[model samples]
Target: MKNWIIIFIVSALVGFGAGYFIFQDKEEADGTNQTTTQEKESKQENVVKEESKDSNAPKTATTSDGGIFSEKGCISCHSVSALNIQGGATGPDLSKAYDNVEGKHGKPIKEFLKVPTSAVMSGVIEGNPLTDEEIEKIVEALKKAAEK
Candidate 1:
């Protein structure tokens, strides 16, 4: 009986220690999803750069239809933070969306945009179809977003 009691206590302590070790440095679980100080500063710099973009300046990757994504209501559910976009939390954050364009959706970006895999997106796309040019521009924007 004494040995069993000692063994149970040791097991409990080990389990507790192991749980703590696994989650000790997990910042994602700490709820640090808000914009960090570095990200804020980076945004400020980007704002300055945007302001200084003249016709002669080297062009940054941008969607040809500047507001097409929002105009067509993508921002209603999706967002691409790297594009300085924010949207409702109905869908995944598209910060690194281009990384898994094919693997996640089982199709290329252009095709996915034209024919969304998700039912929700399918409805959205049905209501607001994107032109070939618009899809091309959006793909460029996604590629640019992935670079960051």
Candidate 2:
């Protein structure tokens, strides 16, 4: 009886410790999630403010950082008309990319903006697919199109 009681006590202690650790980890994860959400919300607010400031401004065919598609040979796969340099249509029609990235298909605009070429192959042609600047410009262009 004494042995059984000691075993039961040990088991209860172990379970309690496990439960406490699990809940503690869960609380930490929840706090991290909250922090990330707040950061994203702040970033979105900034983007909205910038967009509103430029709403009345003319829609420049180029992003705030010039025409990256043309400069980076993206026009080979995509076309913006004015910056014509047509090539293969291996990729989807990018002219209407704004529609896809927006909530038109239930995808958050920010999520879509974060990864413009997510649908595209990770590596095509050469090893390097896209530079950070190129990706940023693409996201910016998408944002501009979404605003329109």
Best by TM-score: 1
Off by over 4 Å in 1: 1-66
Candidate 2 lDDT at 38 equals 54
User: Scored by Cα lDDT, where does model 2 land?
Assistant: 0.52
Per-candidate total of colliding backbone pairs: 0, 0
Per-prediction TM-score:
0.53, 0.36
Best by lDDT: 1
Q: What is the C-alpha RMSD of each candidate to the true structure, in Å?
A: 11.1, 16.3
Spell out the clash pairs found in candidate 1.
Answer: none
Per-residue C-alpha lDDT of model 2 across residues 28-141, encoded as one tens digit per residue: 445553456356446644543464478674332343423666445454455443222232466654555656645454555444434334535323323234666666677667
| The 10-residue segment with the lowest total lDDT in model 2 | 119-128
